[model samples]
Target: MIILPQSIAHVQQLIQPGENYYLVGGAVRDALLNKCNNDLDIICPGGTQKIARRLADQTSGAFYILDKERNTSRVIINESNGDRIVFDFTQLRGGSLEADLRERDFTINAMAVNLTDPVHVIDPLKGGRDLLEKWLRPCSGSSFRDDPLRVIRAIRYSVALDLKMESSTIQELKETVVNLDQISKERKRDEFFKILGRGKTSVSVQLLHSFGILPFLGIENLTNFAKVLQRLRVLDSFMSYLGNDSSLLKRDYFQLASFISGLGKQRKNLSNYLAQPNNSYRTRKDLDHLGAFLWDTSHVDECEVFKKLALSNDESTHLYILLKNRNWLHEFVENGGVLDNRIIFQYFKRLGDAGLDLALLTLADTASVVTAELNHDLWLLELEVCGRLIETWFEHPEVVDPKMLLSGTDLLIEFGLTPGPLIGQLLENLREEQAAGEVLTRQEALDWVEEKKLK
Candidate 1:
């Protein structure tokens, strides 16, 4: 009964009459909710892979089998707007469509609709009513026991759809919380990232902590749990302060959420927890910096914690610079040092592209410590100052990079200096002079380098 014109058209083109297939799961729930969800789950009595292949071939999309034993396959249709529509085709889990619905995680997602007759929804469990009521009810009493990962999914769906958990479902979740340990880390990590990806993660974290799931995830200390919550709050507030600015959008806020979630939790190593294979070098660098921020140890470069985390050389260098410069800037701000053009430029130059992220992180950390009653004005002033600096940096990005006037090779060839560490030192001095506006042109830069050599 939903008006998904394009999706319905696609479905009609792919599915013929008499085909034993139905649109199922979240797709149906979202349709009833009047939400446009491109990720559709379809159930078929058989020929799941055939249907997937046909759909992919017809749409010029890509096809892959998600699970061979379960007869599940996927077809991804790339849209003009750069969005992807994923159609997951799977055979019925049990004997019939009704039975398959019974085995679903939540009542709202347990409904189905015939692919041929899209107007009439098949709600075997009155899931449509639960959707109307905005309540999340398990399809069966043993739902959590059926899959402990459903417990996490319940929280995620609750926050995502803005639904409330039924009282009975809440009790069932509490009773079956211990079974989460039986689930694989990969599944748990996937669900956890989904929750973080939705943003507004503090409530979910609090719910997990209250449900005794944090302990299973390695967070046992109550004090550290409070710190984690504080960090999330700070992050939320800082993101709000950024408003419509899109510069921070390129950074993975989901990873930030994940990092904040594990800040207080004890873990074996950062690499094992992240488990993001095939990540770009920038992503790894960002993760390493985030890990260092969470570790919060003195001498981050030499910290045993980082050593055991198994970061790459580039990741380690980025983390070291981020931590060292962040600490310096934080101390400067705490000591009431003036945030003039010179100081801001110095911090930005030292931090490079990570300067803004570090500034936001510093503000969040400061906000986490400031009490409502004491030094509240100081906290507000600090936030304003940081915001201004970030805005100014974005408006005038030349301060950050400052068009390097001289390279190390240039220093060697122009100054007739031998290939040694002193060339690097001279280039560093030249960059500092350029950033400080002492040397504006190439000639001035050469003069400055020559003058430094005389010194």
Candidate 2:
């Protein structure tokens, strides 16, 4: 393979022939491991931002200083194929790349592949060795302590890349992991979601449980999380969707809560955890919707937590509203109203996904509490049914909303009746009948109204 550099080329060309410029940190780590590399953070000797900025300007890229304290500037260049190429230039390395490489968090991320003149590596930190070994070893324990978010990053890397944490590093992380509180919540959220978006949020969920680090971040009781993962084998897949698929995430929110809350051992904590983010009061409403669905089904005690989580909202009102949204329950109800074309189209427009997801969520939630009835793979069956419902829903809009048929003018002229209350009522009824597929033509609609003996 040709050791080439679209990234390093820029750095090497800008700096003098034998000058000190090295492709350092994450780019080097990913390159050595043969991972797709585009974002490049270079550890230049000193007095190089001018050179870096000039290169970025020549390439018509954008450059901005991230932090003046760190003297780090980010250059964003767009590739011909519309891919983003980011370059990070920092002056903290003094004149030696080793000084900068050692400051990184993990061994795999601390490797520096030199780009100046003759191509060589300055792995004073052995980051390539650790990368080859599939190890998540920190450059130094105190290195991560300088930035506690790295503690979370370590856990994220383990799940995201399917790499194991070196035993010594895991022990080191636990020792200093508690200091993560020193990091801001926004930073914590950033690092946490990085793992989440990597399609490994569920695995990270499990890893957080294995180590005692999760409790420090406020998820002290993980019994529900642990059980939920085991019961619904697709727990990881479901969590994975949260990263890339927002529709599935929003659709599954209720079910995820219901399933986790169903664990039944310590019902309260799990419910609180679900509702404990972004506008707590309204978030509780989302959870209450899930709670009401499971309240009758499972013996999980969530009323008190619901009260604490909620801020003076009507609980029953919420229950009714959520039930209304979930018209799928109407499928199993005594009278679910007719499942005609009009109603199907209305459902399709209101919710992009079919009623099958709701049914599956409920089943999954029930199985989460106790695997007696839903232990089998019924989700596949639900998927097939939902596929048909979704197709029929999108096909027709007028089928769901009957008022599309006609108005008082059309009815009054056809029946030779004046535009009175009776005319309006008769026209609406005709629309309803048409919506229900009971009337096919204007003559048929008029005949039905006459049969009903409307004035």
Candidate 3:
């Protein structure tokens, strides 16, 4: 009777006054950890469904039945006490605390605390030790064998909590990592991104590499996980810009890779625009940008590899342009070699994050190939740049202009040239210049473009 919520007087009324109630699972685990806990699974001494039905009747809660063979049912009560509370009604643990703990995933997750005063803790498995040591170990490898997703979960938690998985558990992962496909992609995606969102995506990726677990997914052929960590702060900050704040970097890789890929498509398209269809120069130029990304890394720079990695036409084009134009030291010197919000946002607006990702990877690549003696100041500058980029995307989304102030038609008529594509490019560049505060109005833009064309 005590298990019934205060609002459900009717359910409490229906109870002939003899049932006992106790808390269970994650709620208790969080309580034990002194972490904020919201899950409210409850164990009822008798007729779990009847308790559920009565509660549902009183509170509009839904009743769900589970494992009819086990005669178990769940009463889902969702209460909005300024926060969501799910009262999961279940039959008492089928066996002793030890047996109940044995049925769970990891040892640390198995422990639960009673909400009753004195806050009695139930630890039939040695979960307390694991939690204290910040270690992750499954109740048994058989549990993981039954459900292989736990393998990734361990890796994910290790990255998230900045902890490590126990040796025995790592062995279990190695055995199960290849069989991960048995699990649903939706589930795998969920787990994979959870690691990413933790700002430990690179860590999880690296571990995946270390254990040879990534080949299971087509996105393997990754170089290093530790490198991802080294690049984490910079990558995350830039991704945050675009109002797509994410710990997991969960946007479609193709969408992002397209944004990042610059050199190859740039040459193909750029050459076509320049009326240089016969020249192989653009292709070599594209390879050179890949070389920029690879210049400081160990791997031999290959143009095909860049093509494979590119996510989109735009990304390929821009990356190609920026790589060939890079004079980071020159840009750094002009800006006093100290990174700030204006500098970061300017780069983000000009190059987008993919180019910056390459910039970040360059540092890591250099260390792997050359020296670990990084300029700490450069690292701070990178992080500051990341924060600035993130802040700008959130603050200002790129809205479409109502109408362009100038046009290619105007350029063609005024300048006495054929109505060619460069006119459009000229107008677009003018708009960008105006947008960037380099010019203020159509008159100023026209004057600037007219002067440039006459040259």
Candidate 4:
């Protein structure tokens, strides 16, 4: 039986009476699995643009032609409740709906249902059966060769949906995995990030490595793959806590019950904290996974293999910062350093909000190696350090990014200093002092600057 989401059913009402439209691809597979998907893919034998344009006009959605040569277009509708619905319209690839389904990437994704007769699933490739069996199979023998990126996508589906790869499909994937180099870097990055965004990133990374895919993505050293996986698994655990999924927590994870209890009240705060986007395209959690994966890789930003991923400057910088300072908090705890306003101020001064990112990275990295009996003391110390940093970031705003006690303009006007680097130096000193509480009021700031000037 084919199931249609209410949004897709509603979209069916917008198409003109006589046009033949088939709801295809992931939308069909998700519907069968009783999953919710706001994005829908529709295909027609001809005149896809006409149908797409009319639908956009009727729904007042923004329209754009995705691929003019293929007659593929898209309509994006913004609902009142802040939910987004995306519809992609394309002409059937081989002039017939059956032929089109046969040309898709995976069996589970190749199924379709005709909108006019939504009850009948048009599965020419037995995709629905594969879905029921929890197996990921190719639509045809050349599925991966036709689009090498599907190799990564197949693994993503497996990890995200808990589907086992069919034996033959796995063999074909191994044979075609090398051709993934022929695919563009941006496309590869998109697929890889999707895997990271999914929950079971450790499993995803392990599969990518076993399938001979990590080398193409610039991961060379398997010596640390075990360590990387451990760190990523720990990172996933933290992510589960941040996402409020306590059930996924393992029994042995009870060892860290004290740390989790400490964060109990700030769960929502931590959730909102990591939910923030690093750029227009990627979130802090996305980088969190990247940081874990590259935990041991040195000079991450300078590596050419990583350069091929074509990450944004902000993303690359964030990853670089996370990896570079992954051990700072650990070392601090090991040294028995105190968590004070001065350190917190300097921490955010160097890392900004990424101080929290570093805190999470350090905790996960530490947790990866913490045995049930070993390093318990160090682990508790690190947790105390991280908890203080996180609490200051969420609860005490002034301690992190304190109000500027003295500005460049203030220095120029007050001390008759010219506009140059000294003014900047003075302002920096004042900010540090103010955040440390050594300089509280404007008069105290002036006196501190005056003392420094006299020196």
Candidate 5:
């Protein structure tokens, strides 16, 4: 018995008499797989815009037209459990539901369940059987040709469901791989992030590479592809390590996306490729930062890449700090694996709120290299040390960057010194001294400033 989610059951109650509505796409597929799915998709013959509006009004949800040409619209209902249920309504393509199913990208998504009779599923292309067989099969030969974006979508579903693609579908994918360039970057970006957002990023990426789709994303050479995939796997492990804490999992999407944004290819070419209007990512600022970090090996032209990508000042500064300080972990290991409090404090102070995020990235990078060399014990030790540093940073943040004990106004008033750039320098010096534990009290800071004045 395939049981529908509560949201789907609620939607079934909204189906009016004589209306030919069917629950379609991922909702049906996931239900058969016994997976939790909040997104509901429905297909109706002729038109869907008017019905979608009425459904939104009845459900007290917000509605928006997703694509005007195709008569696709969506209604978002917020559930009390903090999960969002999205109802996507689309007009039947080719004048009938059967035609619509045939036009879909994959067979698993082509199955539909009639809202009027949920028991009898409408499987025109044997998609239900494919779902049971754990195989991803295209509905037709022209599926990829009709929509080249399906190439990436195929890889996404393969990894998401852990299904093997039918031999024919793989052949179709190879034939249609070249047309991927014709697809809009927005579509590609969304699909790319969707793959990354899933926990098994490394698997999805390897699938894409194996299918010869990496070249379209500017990753032409296969030489460094394995290394990049290893890094992504390391990142996935780090995410799992921190998954016990809900707060960390909440931000995993952006962190994972940023980590793999510039995996393969170095030089301005990849940056140029990403900056193109068609290849623009969802979060352009984050992509630009990651791009700058990956390329610009000398770190001299990050600002140049930022300007080309049209990043904001704050975004540029954050990227700069991350890239500039990414090697701190390497330096620490080189210095006999000693945790120098001063160096750790400086890293936390420079990274500020992004301290933990950058630390994760650095740890993942180091672990990737160490694992490649088969040094499991070293990687475990590094993980423990980095975990402790991150915990201490959150627990005693004041130690990372303490409050100013002396102000510039106090310096001028007591020492009769003229206000100038030297005041800013003195303030920074005092902060460094304070962070280093050399100065702890306001009186000590004042005395230190007086001594500097005498010098």
Candidate 6:
């Protein structure tokens, strides 16, 4: 049932008689599995850049030289619907194509299909059989030793594709797990985020934990492992239903199901909130899982841990605020406090947009502690606090982010004051006043600041 993708056929027509070009790696494997793969990997023995440039010109795609040392180039064809088709052209390693396939990381990724003759596959490592058998195997004995990052990729591919690693592969991964620290933080971070980007985050993370990969990433000592698993499940379910996809919800997760269903119409708001991208490849949902994973009932230096993972400052800051205030909303509800515009304003004031993510995280944390008996009243209280806060964030935008009624210059000029910390403090207080519905106009804002200065 091997069906070549349309992109492959398109490239086949452009192939000249003498060109020694072949489609290799995941693109070939995905084609054999009848999957839709937009990223294609093509190998050229000597003239990778020339072939890449020619393909880019023929297809009217943008071109970039990815690695000059290895002679790797990329062609990106931007589709009308905002999707991109990527073709990576790399210089084939080893002397011949079979040697090149043998040098790859895994059997499943070592297959190739010549562009000139697109019908037959060149699986030198019996990758086609492994694909049929629904198991993972290394292309060679030294696969993991060559690049320890493959250890993480092995777990990711297993969980993502529902394939089991062979017994010997598992043994080798455990032996070389320590060497993962030698890989660059950026590379490890990239592969880890790819795992997060795929769904079933809890399953993937547990596998990483079992395979002893989380320690190197600085997230191994997660407090209360069982409860952490529950929190992850609840968080994943929230991301799913809120993002308008309910397939991730499981039947055993009654509390999560009920909690999400209780959000009612605010589900759409949370969906849009969680859909915000941290970068080109990551979204707020990914951060939610990271928060759930690193969250400790006690305390841990989350910023330092994120630094160890080489996460971007923006991501680290968001997760820091998330874990720091993980219990704020829950304690508020437990202490019999009701949510209002003023409280909501202060919450967002402290956490900014992360306040919404915190609300979801708190909800998941709260749901994880409850049992099957399900205290109806307690669940209701937590839901009301979380739902109303989320509702205000999306329904009443002015409450979370109020328009500035007065500027710093207005304070310095109108009040005849120096531009010190007082001006900044007064401006911040003015925003709180605006959110509280106390200052409605520029004149009112000015008078409010004047009145505050006198105090």
Q: Which candidate tops TM-score?
A: 4
lDDT of 2 by residue, 1-455 (tens): 22635655766667776666667776766665567778787765665568768978888988788877877888888778766687888775534556667778887777666565335656777766766777788776687678877877888777665578767777777777778768765566445435432443445656766766555544344345544443333333233232233333433444444433333332343333333433322343233323322333222233332332233345434443344454354343324344455555555445443242343344444334333434233433333343335334344445644554556776666667676688767766676667668888767866786677653
Score each candidate by Cα lDDT: 0.66, 0.55, 0.52, 0.82, 0.68, 0.81
Off by over 4 Å in 2: 1-19, 47-52, 55-60, 78-82, 165-167, 197-200, 215-223, 230-381, 388-455
RMSD of each candidate relative to the true structure = 8.1, 10.4, 13.2, 2.4, 8.2, 2.9
Shift of residue 22 alpha carbon in model 1, Å: 2.7
- Summing lDDT over every window of 10 consecutive residues in candidate 4, give the lowest-scoring window: 247-256
Decreasing TM-score order of the candidates = 4, 6, 1, 5, 2, 3
As a whole number from 0 to 100, the lDDT of residue 364 in candidate 6 is: 78
Candidates 1 and 4: which is better by lDDT?
4
Worst 10 residues of 3 by lDDT: 276-285
What TM-scores do the predictions have? Answer: 0.76, 0.60, 0.49, 0.92, 0.76, 0.88
Give candidate 4's whole-model lDDT: 0.82
Error of 2 at 74 (Å): 1.7
Clashing pairs in 5: 185-278
lDDT by residue (414-440, candidate 4, tens digit) is 989898888888888788787788888
Clashing pairs in 1: none
Model 6 global lDDT (CA atoms, 0 to 1): 0.81
Model 5 / residue 167 / CA error / Å: 3.0
User: What tens-digit string does per-residue lDDT give for candidate 5 at 145-195?
Assistant: 999989999988887777898688888899999998887655665666567
Model 2 — TM-score against the truth?
A: 0.60
